[model samples]
Target: MKECTGVGEMSEMGRLVLLGAPLGNPADASARFREVLATADVVAAEDTRRLTRLARDLDVTVPGRIVSYFEGNEERRTPELVEVLAAGYTIALVTDGGMPSVSDPGYRLVRAAIDAGFPVTAAPGPSAVTTALALSGLPCDRFCFEGFLPRTPAGRRSRLRALATEERTLVLFEAPHRIAGALADLAAAFGPDRPAALCRELTKTYEEVVRRPLGELAEWAAAGEPRGEITLVVAGAPPVPAARPDDDTLRAAVAEREAAGLSRRDAITEVATAYGLRRREVYTIVHT
Candidate 1:
């Protein structure tokens, strides 16, 4: 019999399981989570201390080897864990809260494991993104999860401007300290009257969700930063009612685009697409 030397050997290949830690309450942890915590051969945690506390809270003893796998060490640690997995040891990857790799570490390891032909799976659990969206009262039917906005004011504004025309509800994670600035920038870019909700300390004691217009939320944050993990859900841009613009309107729209630095050809194409008219019609209107 040939010795199994690669991942194709089912009996010899180990698996990578991503465990989603509770957003706040330990009671939210599923039975499978506790089982994995107790039985995995090794556990890579974003915060080893938090894993210890979570195990204590859930009354599960993690007998496996525990190691820290955060942003600081993820790049350095992924190859090491892959070796462990190659050795047929079940490795459980977890973060302090919520799912790993959602604006958190674990993406690199997951990709690495897959590329190495190792089996990767996730024990799905609580997620702040979905939690905030469900409670936000915004249109959940069509939504986009933007893990976190750019940190600097200018970066944030630039990002918000790009998303200004999005028709899907927007969900974003933000730190408590920067929440105020984020909200203010959000209002400026998305418009002061845009509906939004600020979800804080979700699924934890002192949980608060403030549903208000963008401008109002900015003012509310200005008073004082609300503490705790924050998630923001903002309503998408309102639909533009159908209308046919006159030749003058088309010409003016094209001119506005040109003034904004778009070449005449590109501006005409944009205006034509926006008004559902032919490019030739817009070009004629612009020149005539």
Candidate 2:
């Protein structure tokens, strides 16, 4: 473990520290985080109000200058922060919650620092992403963080459709109100039987994690919207069949569809739906 030092102590050496704060619970903050907050010469925070509240909870006083560094100003602030870093300031970066740069402001500054040969490191803490992953009961060994889905239904659905066949477990963040719609879209794109978990208010008094099939979860979310922060974890699609269907099987499926008095396109669609085969595969078999 590295010892935390004040900015004055490190003024001679230029460095940028990406500090991870507690997602919701202050108790999850590490000792090093307190020290960094206490000593950093410049504290770049996503939200000053939230940062102050966190400082009060931890009983640590920030001796450095605090500045806003959020989505709207990140691009504009990056160059200025970089200048401070170059001037040998031990700058500490923090987000409103959780780790900075995961889905928050800090990436640009960290990247700039690294490119400029300034020392860079992290002080890890609680993450909604990992917390949800643990509660999800889904495979976490291989997973991808999608951050938040698009706000609109069409955009969100399109994004989910693109990941319909993704094999690695998926993690996403959603607002309380949008959770139900997101779940519904996920079920439609990934199938109803896909296992998933909805984590809400993690590490707080009202923290809840509900694990169920995506279809069932969507129904539950529809009944009533949840409050507080949310993290959604969904199981990935199973390995696809390795062998293609033989010509005989395809002919039999097409014959059954034709006997039902359906058009060729409708018949192929029905067969594909019934057998869980791709529409193009069924069409190729029927046409050829």
Candidate 3:
């Protein structure tokens, strides 16, 4: 909510528009994005230089003030932009590439404007997340985005462990250098045979999407690092085995643990560990 002054107010009817720039190629920018950039009273961009370059490439001179809007300065800039929106200025928000707020900075301003009751809208464009997901050959009807895995091995493993049971397809972003390590972690957590796709340099001249099992990809990535933006789409875990525990089975397990003087929690943990079953699944039977 940083304050910006001296910029004149907009008409009461002016609306705040979030424009999605192309991920790489300038020609990919939509006609609507060009029109809005040309006509808007203010252009807020993630990187001013890149925005100017894009405008130059589009051959469309932005007719208003161009301000830098990025992660470091978003907190300070959101309020100023909000004021512009409140004053009825047609402000066009764009990132260096792709839609703002997807993994970019437009979310703060957009959220602020929306909460303030200002009209906000978007001009759709290329999205790496969806593009990779679509090309992954996995179930896309239902999915979730887990942006950028944790950097530390321990943190990343814990994250993967938590998602090991996720039933919906999982989408993740990774740096080219870290792709191999990420795949290794995925293999360890989701099992080697889990299906996955490695999408690299999406939408560019050298764009490549390689689909394979997590373990194989990890082995391939070990030879050399791939280039460009990377998106990893991993298939979710298979449904858990649905076998019901018989009375004898549950009673036998309980008796063994009780004879060892183990607490109910400890017994359930051991039995679940031994049987490759979910702790909750084993606990349900023992408690029942």
Candidate 4:
């Protein structure tokens, strides 16, 4: 008999299950979610208190060992949880809201279980990412999920600048207190005219989706500190064809590039390609 930290380590067979929690509304809890919550042999959660509260709200009593498995202890608890799994028990993983391992805990334990050749499955439920995107009024055909922006203003701005030319729609998470600052940074990086939507308190009583250009959104958010969780969906960069450079413009640009350190031949080639003219023509211009 061995004692592992997280939950039941008494069994000899092991498997893992990740359960998605409701973001805001408890009624959104599904039947299967309730069943698993009540019957799991061992339950591990990002917040054990939240888990108990959820079970109470759902009118279900968890008949299993309850343990904490959140961010601060993921590294410490993964091995312990893995041991319980290796010991022939079913360990259910949950978070405060939404899918586990998505801007939440569960990845480490899942990875360790897989590496140990243990069975891993999930009870998929509500997700803020998909919910916000569906109501964002932006093209969802091709999009990217950017979980959360950097806390620092400068760091966030730098990250946004790198994504400036990204063509796919973007989904981002932000804290309530920092939403205004984040929106302002978005305006600077993506331009004031870029279209975007701010999703607030999704699936909750005060749920709201504000759609506007980046500039307007920044100004609106600045009015006051908004409450609740925030998700932002930004329209992809508009496709623009490179302009055909005129002869004079090409020559001037190439000269400027050369003065800035490009080789003469490279400068000629660069200008010719930009203007869709012959390299020999630019060579003639540079020489003559």
Candidate 5:
């Protein structure tokens, strides 16, 4: 069997280490994360200030050069980071919280590094997605992570409508200020009775998780918007019961089939089989 190469094994070309920072608590950072931050040749952070604060909190010194790499600058910064990788200098990418490139600024650099033939790996750590899912008491067997909802109300509603029938549990991230409006729209689109949980400031000192129906959650948010990072876990849509065709519809089906060269008896059989009914039942309806 082929063996998996370790992240520490650096080739002539330096690797890109994707670091998953603590969701909120600095203590959640792993030992490998701290080591990478301390020893990497370059640390590309979504927010340099947050990275500095996190380093300070973890008692880790970032000896490498630090640079701002965010949404606004990702396109321009990716090439430079790749160039650093080409120079045999390991580049560690960290976001403000959680894993980078997860609705964060790390995709471009990852793609660039891979395309440039540089190795890319991660120092796995805490994530708000799984944290919120576990705390929500929702089924995690099958789920989807929708990083953030559309910024505009119309766009959000449109997106929600498309997902209304999704059977798998749904997870989403929302900004503090937009939490209220997002909840309201969720209730409107997914229906009031849909079960959901709201997770805030996960893994932090004042963390909160509220499990409620969409209606109650919307009402709660309307009363007062909760602060801090918001993660929403919503139950999937309930199974829709199949409706049996009525007398008029059954008659129409027989007539349509008869018009299509099927005999009345054959049409009744076809319609009965198609609608999962006995031939006698369809015949009575067709005759009556």
Candidate 6:
């Protein structure tokens, strides 16, 4: 591609550009990231200060009007940003870290821009999700993203229980303070021997990627405070036995899962699928 600077220069009326920034190390920033931030007419940033700091580090002079659009004010600010975008102005939406709308707030504006007949796209760059998954040494052919989990212990456990039998590799973002609790929940929900990796401060000086089972990870985090941003990659559940699971076997499996705090309904569904049986049969077996 040529050296394209501005979005308005294209054939579209207005464009909503999701500009990606580095997760930790600023050098991972792409040239296109700088160009979009430097030339776009309206720049919507999760944090204005952080954007400026990034530009300074990259030696890229920002020539656009910067506006704050984070989780707190995204709902209120969507209309205003859509208006600017509708007027043939290019607006770059960036987050404090990572891309917009992954775990950050930009979906509303992106939707509004699209509804208004404006073009939308992303200036792709570093993402903690893909980066961590690449280094996680786990299956990546099929995977899923489980953003930040609930804060309350009960709520978190409930969500983990729901995902207990998920077969695809899972990617999650978590805060430092809740690392131990989350790992413990994973251990309890997915079993202590479940394979997992904890990636911390990605691409930064204190960066650490610890690969182990959920139990060992929980123990490690309990030993010391694991600080900074965290991305967790968890291996999927192991394959079940080839032998057809009988009613007694299915009931035991469901009961064990239910005892692990999963709802009866979820337990039945999981057991039914695991043994390739109709949900009605599993439901009858569990309820009666």
> Which tens-of-lDDT digit does each residue in 1-288 have in candidate 4?
433322334445576878989998999888878887877788999899989999999999999899999889999989998888766788889999899998889888888999998778888999989899999999999999989999999999999999988999999999988999999999998999999999999988999999999999999999977789898999989876577666677778888999999998999898788766789988887786
CA lDDT for candidate 5: 0.89
Query: In order, what lDDT does every prediction score?
Result: 0.90, 0.88, 0.86, 0.87, 0.89, 0.88
Candidate 6 overall Cα lDDT vs. reference?
0.88
lDDT of 5 at 140: 95
Model 2 Cα lDDT, one tens digit per residue, 1-288: 233244435554577877888888899899999988998889999999999999999999999999999999999999998888767788899997788889888889889888987788888887889889988899999999999999999999999999999999999999999999999999999999999999998888999999999999999999999889899999998988656568778778788878889888888888788777899988888778
TM-score of each: 0.82, 0.81, 0.79, 0.80, 0.82, 0.81
Which portions of model 6 miss their true places by more than 4 Å? 1-12, 245-288
Instruction: Report the poorest 10 consecutive residues by lDDT, candidate 6.
Output: 1-10
Instruction: Spell out the clash pairs found in candidate 6.
Output: none
For 4-50, candidate 1 gives per-residue lDDT tens digits of 23222224778888998999999999998998888888899999998
Off by over 4 Å in 2: 1-12, 244-288
Q: Show the lowest summed lDDT stretch of 10 residues, model 4.
A: 1-10
| Pairs in clash, predicted candidate 4 | 11-87, 12-87, 12-88, 13-87, 13-88, 13-89, 14-88
C-alpha RMSD between model 6 and the true structure: 10.2
- Deviation in Å, model 4, residue 185 alpha carbon: 0.8
Clashing pairs in 2: 7-39
Instruction: Give candidate 4's error at residue 194 in angstroms.
Output: 0.9
For this target, which candidate reaches the highest lDDT against the unseen true structure?
1
RMSD of each: 8.3, 9.8, 9.1, 8.0, 5.9, 10.2
**lDDT tens per residue, model 5, 182-206:** 9889899899999999999998999
Residue 220 of candidate 5: its Cα lDDT?
96
Residue 115's C-alpha lDDT in candidate 1? 98
Tens digit of per-residue lDDT, candidate 3, span 1-288: 323221223566456788888888888999998888988889999999999988999999888999999999999999998887766678888997778888888888888887887777888888888989999999999999999999988999999999999989999989988888989999999999999999988878888999999999999898889988889999988888667567569658967997899988888888777767778887887767
Worst window of 10 by summed lDDT in candidate 2: 1-10
